[model samples]
Target chain A: MNEALLAELRAALTPARVRTGATELGLYRRDASNIEGSAGVVCFPRTTEEVQACVRACVRHEVPFVPRGSGTGLAGGATPLDHAVVIALTKMDRVLSVDAVNRSAWVEPGVLNLDLTRQVAHLGLHFAPDPSSQQSCSIGGNVANNSGGPHCLADGVTTSHILAAEVVLTDGSVVVLGSEAWETHGLDLRGAFVGSEGMFGIATKLCVRLTQNAPAVTTMLMDFESVDAGAHTVSAIIADGMVPAALEMMDQLCIQAVEAYIHAGLPTDAAAVLLVEVAGLPHGVAADAARIVEIGTAHGARSVRIAQDEAERALLWKGRKTAFGAIARIKPNYYLHDTVVPRRALPDVLRQVYEVVERHDLLVLNVFHAGDGNLHPLLVFDKREPGVMARVHAAGEEIVRISVEAGGVLSGEHGIGLEKRDYMPLMFAPADLAAQAAVRRAFDPTGLANPSKVLPSPAGCGDLQHVPEGAWV
Target chain B: MIDLLAFAAEVGDAEPVTITGLGTRGGAVPDVRVVRAPAGIDWVQADEMTVCCGAGTPVDELVTELAAYRQTVALPAGGTVGGALAVGRADARQLGWGPVRDALLQARYVSAAGEVVKAGGPTVKNVSGFDVCRLLVGSHGTLGFIGEVILRTRPLARHSQWFHRADVHDPSDVFTTLYRPVSVLWNGSAVWVLLEGHPDDVAEQAAVASLVACEGPPALPTGSRRLVPPAQVPLLTGGFVAELGVGVVHHAEASDAAVRPERAQVLDHTVRQALDPSGRLNPGR
Candidate 1:
């Protein structure tokens, strides 16, 4: 690290907020993606002004920087680069204000996703984007990923709920994109910025839309003899014009793992299970739930279990959210692939996913947002086994290719950070990639903000670099 | 279309180029050459609740075509598909549906340098890139010309309207009490509520609303302006219509207030330059 640059950073922010010790740098190096990278230093900014000051110091020193929230991103989006500074925004967690009339709240980027819902639950309103890691992930991270959850099937993603953001640009300039109003004139820069994966700049504050709590909610779990049956049921429910608040699916492997770990009452004998929830007025919710149950039964559901109370409902969701973590009981390491296909193509895609993994001699478990056809196929492997990692990577790539071939996307919620950066070409052509790079250059002309992520480093594209092998899991 | 691309490439380094679609939003550019949509390119294709159409297709014609499938775009009646996407406005029934941008599943457009670029795909849920499909929406033709768009459509709602004359202050209560109204419009002196859904559901919701409202002499108000934040609806002195659930408001009279684009940072300008290096497309709009 440059001593002069360190001094400048220390001067801009208090010495207590700036840390250069190896221990501190190590703590900020890795995220939930399990990818590790080295950092020059980690600075925790307590306010937007402090964040701006830290950015300015990096700009003046010509040092690359990465802004991070809770570091819960699964895509290594918050991973730091070697010789770069990690500006962690954890200390800036605070809800600035809540406008119940407008059904919106102003909060710092570091505010945890679920904390916002807890704060406004008393007013009969809540934030709708409930990612599996909502308890630990920051709103800023959610915005960075445009995070989606099961409820996103009906409520939309994080970008849909975000009203505006106060962002600190690369040169340390502060600009507000979007507004508290429902709509804004000019370019929808806020829409562009939300899912940029921190390449553009750091969002200091976010004005997020809040949704009213439904007067009634019905949660149910249905078991099927085969994955195709469950998938068909999902398509049938949607085709019937019933939009459930949340619809998720877990395969036999995922169900066995969750049942073994938490005893969530999942049927161990079932080939697949669909967890469905509907929310609205009492009559509407009841009607929708009945219709969903009818459809599931028609599609060969072995059994349909409706939650008798909120506690049971919570327990059911706990099983679904912890399905990823429960996979730990099966394999020491797993690479979760996020992709989406048309609802009608779910069955065909699942078969292809199974074939790819089977050919590789890998055990892959399926748990995903069924309503939106966002599949999370977890490839389970033991890294200690010789050549297992290579097989996992190949299978993961095949799944992505197949999903895109089925008219889906490279990613659904987890962003195209270091993990999927090179695979972007599978979904986009050279000209499309160049257009996106232009957008990135428009924001970070210096290429000093979260470099080597999102768009690939095309030739002569400024100082953009590739994610080093050290940054991979 | 190939000729247009060739022309654009020929003039890549010259002044910015303007793209015109049906010439609906405004007349021809003052000083720039306008590239109109090619002949015989206006077409619409619908499949499984999704519609893909050329940018030059008029919104009215597209709506009529989608009506055969009992589907529709959540955009107003006028303007071309490209123009509607360029402006990116949400209709009065936004509460039941969504904004125009949300309906955009995929798009293909020509950059100022004549490179045909595509973002997103023909899928309902996609998070591939930065969602360039949405980024292009409401771009006001500054970035590039929207050549084609694929949109997710919704089943047309069975429409019904109910009007009640009441001097209600702070109409937020109606949103809290009513159940899933398609639109709640306040015309200054009275409120006009539109409901659309299954006949039984709509009638039930309307009855519940009517119980709280006392019928009176009808009053008509004109020159309404739309506002977004429901909290700001009470602040507007004139009569306005508030889509209670959607948090959109329409005032009785138009206001000259404008959000200054100059407030945007250097990044926005940089993006504009990258997409239209020659500053040719809707320059300085």
Candidate 2:
């Protein structure tokens, strides 16, 4: 933890690679969640050996270290809570190998989300797990959060896309978790590592599944008179035995904010908007689009629009993808939270969420992946206003409660970062949390990797961050 | 009882008992207890698309069903809804589909007492886990057990298709596309392009596949397997292609597909996870 030790670490990497200044340390202290802390020193390790060396140095010095990727995470997952060393992996970006015929990629975790696709474009293969921030987020962050995006409705979350990973455990021991060669000889330690929210160790390299680009694609944007109708449309489509690539829903508040910010021409008059996308054979694509139009009209769609070309598709998606930034532009501050439920219960959950937000006297912008039941309900607030941040937190907590009550979970993709750490008990029992914690302990016994995040403090065991409905029931 | 966890014997035909690997999936279970084999169970073939394992095995230890293949149970999402015929929970179209079961071609296991049994050889579809050998597929622990499972491997599909158009001025366009597909019986979810066949056939399809927002015709990040027709070119391509001209597809998406010790264990574990409180096998712990 001293400068001499830090200097020794700096000698391992380029001197310019290590950052120890106040401004740089401040920047590395938190992720998008804005949690505050300080790191003794931050080093960008470019190779697995350097990472091992950093871990050995930390072990030798008895200092804790946190491995960081792109800081686009909402959970403060990459935030440094203690005076630990931050081993950032952005410099290690490399697409090591692509087995085109096999449909998989071996990459260093620092590789950007979209870079893998760029590298594999020639082989008729592409990595499928895409978070909205794919352009900026690192694959490491995606692996840590088990991030899910719109396409996940059909493809699945990050855990599904990760076939194998090479991790550097906290003890400076370089042990491979999953196998690229196929089949581990013993217990599947890989399943427990994903979505551990950086509590286990650093994912240095990943073997991820890349998908074939569909031959044809069709995107649609539709407006409904009510969010309920929009929600029902998603279930109706699925029940009809059709699974679209992506089905996203946004309420009027979200639409208005996004439209105002981007001039993307989102319909402000409708109560909600559903963005639906389908892909396949040319005939199948056209047929599916026609059926969706039929369903929308029957369900009382106010209006619907289809993108005519790639430009139109970009325009249509701009609003949905940059929605967070757009809303942030409108409001000085906002609390973003994610929850997921079974697709069938979306209507009830959305309705309850609206009522709860109203009760708290807060503004809510609802944006969600409708097909998979992953909801990102943003509570807009100005932190400068006293008690507003706390109010937004409470309302946000309520929305997660509603999701859990409806047979959902506290997180679909954002992960149980520092923001939702206190709320972990709302979704899991003490024993269940302990089981997850045990998995973390097995991977990182020292508790040095991004500590004090997902689970609540032991002292506040009885504090209710999320209210279960039965508290009154 | 055959110590199903033991690993030191290779039984000949004259050996009266049957040697079973983890019981196969599909159809009914034969009535017989099993002896265990330990170190004798090992993965013999490890490649990009397929992995072959010894019968007395655990699927959970097989590659963690990672990436695009871990969504629902290979037999639909709810639970072990179907009988324990599906080993890997492979195909989305059919729960407990045929391909994963068919992958178990080579097997060597011991019988109730101490007889080694063998079925299906080392080929992709060695015709081993068939009616005679398949009776041990899902019998909990009854019948001949498994000593090995030879998997049929495949390459991941390269392309997925989303047919909706983008860049529209009016909202009606969205409505038209969303509803038009539903009106007709068109499956609107992303189109999957798992293809296998001659290079000319693949080239023909690739030539027609549009390049608007398409991502690849290149190598993938790792290894993948697909269920493709032998004669048709897949719209998308992947890495490490392997083709076995069989009529089976594995449901790699199932949570239990990569973890089932045996098809029979699927039922017992799920029921145990749901019904058993206090981790007790006996009633009213």
Candidate 3:
């Protein structure tokens, strides 16, 4: 970074807001994905205006920069590139207002995901997208990834919950997409920006839609003798026209890991377990829960259990919430892959996933939002092992191929960051990729805002280079 | 049927092209060559939970086909799929079923450069690209000429009708308190609730809602409908139906300019520049 440019950036905002120390810049270099890169400096903007000023300075200096939220993104989306400045948005945290009557909240980009729900809990409203890292992830990060959670099957993802946003473009201009109004007549620009993975611009403020708390709830756990049966039960539940608040599945490996870590009373010996929750009117919820249990049993569930109360329900969810963390006990490192297929194809896709795991001789766990067919296959391996990383990458690529071949997508919730950028071609053709690139070019014509993320660069051939012929078969 | 590829090629690098459907919304732009999808291109393919159809397919025809499967697309009653998707309007039921964007699973369109581009896929959930399928929705042909679309459909409610005569203003409370309703419409003088689902669930919810409103079920009204936000309801003087929970108001008297989302103009222009660099498709509108 040029010293003159640094001085200009310091002049644009408060001098205290800009930091060049190695210690400060080091912290902003990497996110949860651990894809580290050198950064020019770290800017902690406390307000949207301050953010605009920093963006203007970066633009004036022709500097590439990355906007970062809580650094909890699993896709290395927040990992700064070499010669890029890190715009850390943690200081912008604030809930501007909450409209209890309208059931909406105006919040700054840095507001913690769970904090929004906490702020509205008094009014019996809550933000629905509960990504496992809700405790630490920022709303802006959720918007960047279009993050989904267990309840997303019923509630939809971040894009669905978001009503509007005030964003700072790369050119230092601010644009508001969407509005407090339920129907915006113009183009759905907000929808396009939600999952762009920071390539479009940085969102300074967001107006998020809130959902009312369901009056009644039921949570149940069903153990199956085979993972295929669990997948079949998920299809049956959806086919029955029942949309559970949450429907999750955990294979034996995931159950064992969670049990060893938290002792959530999961049946480790079972091939898989389904955690289903229904919420609505008391009578309706009871009816849905009964129907789900009946379907699970008919589909070869060995045992079925319902949470006795709220405490038991909370206990049931604890294991799923912490399943990712528990995988650390199984291996020092794990690459979590997010893919989605049609509900009917879930059985075949899972079978293909296990086949890949067996081929790679790796311990992979299946824990995912099964109701919507979003699978998170955690491939556990030691990074220090010589050939293990290569095999894991190969297996991950194979899984993505299977997913796309089965008429699914490259990603379900986690945005395609550096990790999956190459695999995008497996699901999209060149024309599709070019059209997406055109949208990016329009947003950041200079290609300076979070460059080299989401869409693959034009020069590189995609993941097909690594896969062998008929490998998917 | 007009050859979309040939039309796109003819208009290649053209300064302006007025894309038209049935022109139900208004008149054509002056001093510009008009291009429209030819008749008989309408086609519909319905599966268990989704429908794929030609963009020129009439919304009523699509609705009728989905109704046969006991499923329905959550769009308005009249207009072509291309028009409804291009305008991207949501009806009263958006409170339960999401907006028009939510139903859209995939779309294929011809770009200003005459190249065919497709976004999204034929599935309920996909995060593959930049969500261009949704970006095209409500774009009003400024982006591209939508040729085909795949929409997620929902099972039709076993029982559905408007139950009126309940007096309530600002029914946001009902939305926050009760189970999600298919549609909650409020006229100037009375509230009209549309309940759909299993007979028992609908009856129980409607009974509870009526109890909360302290009124009896009234007669239903018949007429044309338009959808707007709840906040804009009080501004209207005449009788109009408002979807309370979803915050969509249906009034034929509603002004299109009033709901135009002017705040997003800059971003919309930027997107238009990218998708339609030649500025030929629906040049001014």
Candidate 4:
């Protein structure tokens, strides 16, 4: 935020690239979430070297630098920390290479997720991990959070897709982890960095695996009388050995909100809805969809509707994608918590969450990636209320604890940024936390790169805090 | 070496002390402490996974016993389980299917304070707490020593095959091409392929591989072998369109002892220094 540091950053990058102007700074203040914060300065670096230069400058001045991509993150990951430097990687977007035979692509951090799929669509190849923000979220951020989409059940998460990376270390030294050439190497650094939440470092370029897009995509919408029924249908489908490309669940509140916002003709009266998509060869998709319908009906589904064309399928997804935004129309503010439980525990977890919501007298619109047990409970709260923020935070924390107790994780893909940093003890022990810290030290020893995230502050007590557990299954 | 000696003496009194075999390759590399066997000890077997060998038992001996069944003990044959797992290393191809650490379903080790600790169960998947079995695999003997490592074994492959696309002009091209045959790539020209299905399926894939390569008349490869690393395999087939330095190959082939015909030994020494700064173990120059 100092003028000297700003001048140094401007000197390293083009003056046009460094933006601290009120309006531009305003745009980088907050991510898609309701968390309010601001950055001291924001810079758009076009090249890896430019990013390194900015990093070095920040390192020299001891200014914390937070990497920001599309800012589509809902986990408060991209929300700027006060008095910190924000490195916006949007300008670094570039699809460097596509190796179809190898089924890999080396792309800059700023390339949009959807754009990668579009580029490889003609070749019958596509990148998996299609988060709802695929159209806006950057591949770099996806790598940072190890983002997972509804289709993650079949395609796997971002960590699976990432092959290698050109990372700019905290000290601004560029090092390549995991070669484009895959080997049974010394250590699986690739595995460690995938979900490290930028606490590791900035990934300048990524070598990610590209899959042969399924020959056909079949989408269907099924309605159940209760969220429990919908969850049961999911279990049945998985139990029957049918892995849909995506199995998304929506509560009545979510369906009503999406219907009002997108007008995609969702069943507003239904207690819960399941959006199912199957992609593979034509025969395989047809068989999978048929079996899915059988499972849904067996689990007490009230209705089933299959989309016939690409246009119809797009409309169906448009409604689901807009589900979070639609809640904003209902409430002035909302806190979205990403908690995951085991797949078998989906029905029970959903039931328990509903009970907790009722007890708190809060409206929680549930939308979950059912196949993976990733629940996105959108807690509607008016921030203006005296105790609303505290209550919402408490509810969010409770949801995370429940998932953990159920043998799940705090953030499946959103990651443990400042929002979830304090809750790390729920998922990891002191020694485990120390091991993760060791990895962080190997990458960013000074803790200058995106500090105060992932590892909870040392002052927090190590003793486990017991709370009302959420239903795992 | 001096630092390692000093630390070893300082912590010499500990039990189940973590000790590394070669102190090379990360992950699944066991760090073990020397524990004297019970005076009249026969064999101490907890489950099918691991057994208590003498403190001085080499990794190769342990691997042979553990993988004596129809299945293997999830460790690579080329190296000992202890040496293979020093820094938590796994074959990239086999990692998804499972890794050496995964096969270590249970382990019994002596703690620094000489307290015996048992981890994991006979079941293939156990996630009780701490995952000490996996933790010990690559801990480099920094924590508690690995007294005895219990590991789960899988049925070994009865029929295996090797394939080579001998005519490719460049080594790196193999990495670029031949995406299938996803078993192992060595030296850049020869691909060590393994088919683990029925005998008929193995024969079928061998026939397809020959057809794809346009190799000599099709036949089962009983004696033939290939050992090219995936990254540089294309180079063996005379595919050297782009010339890369010897350093890349040296780093990639860190484990293999076979020396290259054209490249000098300087690159290997450089790589050794880069990886093993302390020069504490496995000093094979």
Residues A138-244 of candidate 2: C-alpha lDDT, one tens digit per residue: 99988888788888766656765776778787767666664542323223345446677777778889988777677778898999989888988887676554667
Residue-level lDDT of model 1, residues A1-473, one tens digit each, is 97887898888788998998889888888778867888899999888888888888888888999999888887778888776899999998999999886578999999999999999999888999998889999999999899998898878888889988999988788889887765676677888888899889999999998887877899999999999999999888876666689889999999999999888788999999999999876666777888888899999999999999999999999899998889999989988888988888899999999999999999999999998889999999889999987788678778888998987888888888887787777778888988888887787788999998877666523222343463332
C-alpha DockQ of every model: 0.50, 0.04, 0.47, 0.09
For model 4, residues A296-346, the per-residue Cα lDDT tens digits are 898888889899889999999988888878998888777777877766667
Docking class of 3: acceptable
**C-alpha lDDT score of every prediction, in listed order:** 0.79, 0.59, 0.78, 0.62
| TM-score: model 3, chain A | 0.96
Give the range where candidate 2 chain A is weakest over 10 consecutive residues by summed lDDT: A464-473
Q: Any idea what lDDT model 3 has?
A: 0.78
Q: Candidates sorted by TM-score, descending order?
A: 1, 3, 4, 2
Off by over 4 Å in 2: A181-183, A457-459, A462-473, B1-285
The best candidate by DockQ is 1
Tens-place lDDT per residue, model 3, A325-437, is: 89998789888888888777888999999999999999899999898788899989998999887798789888888998987887888777776777777777787899999
Off by over 4 Å in 4: A462-473, B1-235, B238-285
What DockQ would candidate 2 receive versus the native complex?
A: 0.04
- Predictions in order: chain A TM-score: 0.97, 0.94, 0.96, 0.93
Model 1 C-alpha RMSD to native: 3.5
